[model samples]
Structure formats: structure tokens, C-alpha cells
Target: MTEVSKITLIGHSGWGPVEEAYEERLTVSAAEVTYRYHPIKATAENVAHRWRYWTDGPALVNAFENLAAVVSTW
Candidate 1:
């Protein structure tokens, strides 16, 4: 048998007043999760790459959840 552990990381950046606080709450709610601000030069290329790895690419054995937002739509 293999041991498995699931971790959900909610990356939050460029959030408004409301959502910004919401992210904080999520961080507190999670028992063991990582949270951080994306780098200034995190462009689309890096975003896709990170997402793929975070979700375990080419395996379909792991799962991930993304909570991204656009200021224009908020």
C-alpha cells in the first residue's frame, strides 16, 4: 500500500479588499496548506507551468484547485 496526502494551495495575488481578506480566511481554515504571493514577473508562461506541476501533470493521479480572479471583472 502507498500513503497519500492531499494538499490544497490557494494562490492569491492582485486581490481586492474583499477577496484579499477572503484568501486570508482560507489560509486560516486550512489545517496544512501553503499560501504565498506570486512573483512580479509571473507571466502566463509560468502560470501554466506551475499549474501543471501543482496538479501532477501526465498522471491524473493527483488533483488541484485554482482560485484565480481578474480585477476588471470584480
Candidate 2:
């Protein structure tokens, strides 16, 4: 059996506030974390096409790099 050591949860939404706090609000610590920064105005039509908002920019690259670095330690 493979025991899970660490995990990360990525979330997305259609819209949100102007700025969001990415800090964890839990009092306990564990091997899991979450991230939810994207908040685009999307609809069914948008979903039909590729997710260009985040895919075709440095944000994705930076996010990927950060994710990789975090996972590397787990």
C-alpha cells in the first residue's frame, strides 16, 4: 500500500473579491494544503474553449514552479 505523505488542493471559481488571502486558517498542522486564487468571469461558452486566462500567462508557470518546489519536499 502507498501511504499519502503530502497533498495540495487547487480550487477555482467564476468570481471573487478583488484580493484574496491565501493563508491557511487552520489551527492544526498536517501534510495537506490548499490554494484558491483564480476568480475569472466565466460561463458555459468559456468552458467550451481552453482555459486561456491562466494557461497562457506567467501565472500558470509561476504557480507550477511553486507547486513543484513545494511537492519536492514532501
Alpha carbon RMSD to native, model 2: 11.9
Q: What would the per-residue lDDT of candidate 1 be over residues 1-74, giving only the tens digit for each residue?
A: 32233434464455544323322112211123344444444444433222122332433332222222121123
| lDDT (10s digit) by residue, model 2, range 1-74 | 34333344544433445243222221111322333333243343332221212234566555555655666667
On lDDT, the candidate that comes out on top is: 2
Global lDDT scores for all candidate models = 0.32, 0.38
Q: Which ten residues in a row have the lowest lDDT in candidate 2?
A: 20-29
For every model shown, the clashing-pair count is: 0, 0
Q: Please give the distance, in angstroms, between residue 8's alpha carbon in candidate 2 and its true position after superposition.
A: 9.1
Query: Where's the lowest-lDDT run of ten residues in candidate 1?
Result: 63-72
lDDT of 1: 0.32
